[model samples]
Structure formats: structure tokens, C-alpha cells
Target: MEEFTIINENNEFKKGKVISVFNISNSNREIVLFSSEDFDSENANLQIAYLNIDADGYNYISQIDDEKVLKEAMYIVKDMIEVINNG
Candidate 1:
């Protein structure tokens, strides 16, 4: 699996697998990343990320309409990956 190098605001680094990349159009794109199995199936939109992860057995950070949340989540995930890499 291809891994992504993520750096958080606290100078943390993390590695995540790229689950899937959705191409809305030629110029628009989105991806989903998952670090664990904790996923919800009820909400379609919310689970879009998880579905991509589960369907492909990979992880990826998404680029969706909500840039703020994606950035925050990416920060946290990067921090967590740093901890795992360090230890």
C-alpha cells in the first residue's frame, strides 16, 4: 500500500495508506483515510470516508468541501501517527 507522510501543527509526523480517491470532475477530487476500524454505517455522507477505507482496505485523508474539518482531522491523525512511529 502507498503511504502518506502527514505533518501536524505540533510537529508530529504520521503515515497513512491511501484508501481511495474520488474524482467528482476533472478539477474536483476527494479522498478518505482511516487509521482504525471504528466506523459508522448509518450516515452515508459521514461514512463516505470510512466506506472508501473499508472497500479498498486502505486509508487516506480526504479533500472535501469542508476544508477546515479535514485539516483538523489530518492534524490529529498526523500527531497520532507520530506517536506510533516514535514508539
Candidate 2:
């Protein structure tokens, strides 16, 4: 797994790890699976999110959106994963 810190357009930061990646059928897009930790919570449970990535960039299929932030996070996660797998 690769650690990452993704910041939204509102400047909110989410620290997590790239748990996995899924390819979408009939499309040139991929889903970057992530698991974030909520440190403020008592239990510190893991939060999961799926970010979509294409040629243009990344975006989440939700009302809270920021393509630029998602794109940067995806690139970082992808690079880290590739390095680890190749090594």
C-alpha cells in the first residue's frame, strides 16, 4: 500500500493509503481505491473512497468534487504503487 495525503478544493486534507485499483468496464477510466484514517474519532476507523481517473484527471462521483485535487492524488498513488510493484 502507498500512503497519500489528498487535499480538496476547500483545503481539507485526508491522509490515507491506496488500498487497491479497479478498472471500469467499457471505459478508459480506473478507480483508485483508498482507505483513510480518522484520527479525531475515538475508534479511529478507516474510511474508504473510490476516485475515478481518466486521461484528463481524477474525480469522485459525488456532489463534493475537485478534479485537480483528485488528479494529483491519483498520480501520486499510481506512481508509488508502480514503484513498489516493479521493485
Candidate closest to the true structure, highest lDDT: 2
Q: Give the TM-score of candidate 1.
A: 0.32
Query: Scored by CA lDDT, what does every candidate get?
Result: 0.45, 0.54
lDDT for 62 in candidate 1 is 40
| Residue pair clashes in candidate 2 | none
Model 2, 3-87: lDDT tens digits are 7665656776666666675543433445556665544563332333445545776455322144654555556666767899998
Writing each residue's lDDT as its tens digit, candidate 1 over 1-87 gives: 554455545665544445433433323334455332212332211222322354676644543456665565466556656888998
Give TM per candidate: 0.32, 0.40
Clashes of each: 3, 0
Local error of candidate 2 at residue 49 (angstroms): 7.6
